[model samples]
Target: MTKKVLYRIATLLGLIAILFVSTASTWYIYQGDTPEELL
Candidate 1:
């Protein structure tokens, strides 16, 4: 049971990390295209 819980937590963390990276990259690219608007 404990192992299952840990696995779930790890999976959640991995998904969150992936989403964070994707969002960061997308924002970075968008800012590159529209530097004036972001500022």
Candidate 2:
């Protein structure tokens, strides 16, 4: 594959990873009805 193709794939994968992580983080922060341990 070309370097440009590889870089695009890498960037897409990174973005997907970031989206996945942020979604999970938001769910974790907002999913509960009680006080968190850190609060």
Off by over 4 Å in 1: 33-39
Against the true structure, whose lDDT is highest?
A: 2
lDDT of 1 by residue, 18-37 (tens): 99999999988887456576
TM-scores for every candidate against the unseen true structure: 0.79, 0.79
The residue pairs that clash in candidate 1, if any, are none
- What is the lDDT for 26 in model 2? 97
- Give the per-residue lDDT digits (tens) of candidate 2, residues 1-39: 699999999999999999999999999989877567766
How far out, in Å, is residue 23 in model 2? Answer: 0.2
lDDT scores of the candidates, listed in order? 0.91, 0.93
As a whole number from 0 to 100, the lDDT of residue 6 in candidate 1 is 100
Clashing pairs for model 2 are none
TM-score for candidate 1, residues paired by index: 0.79
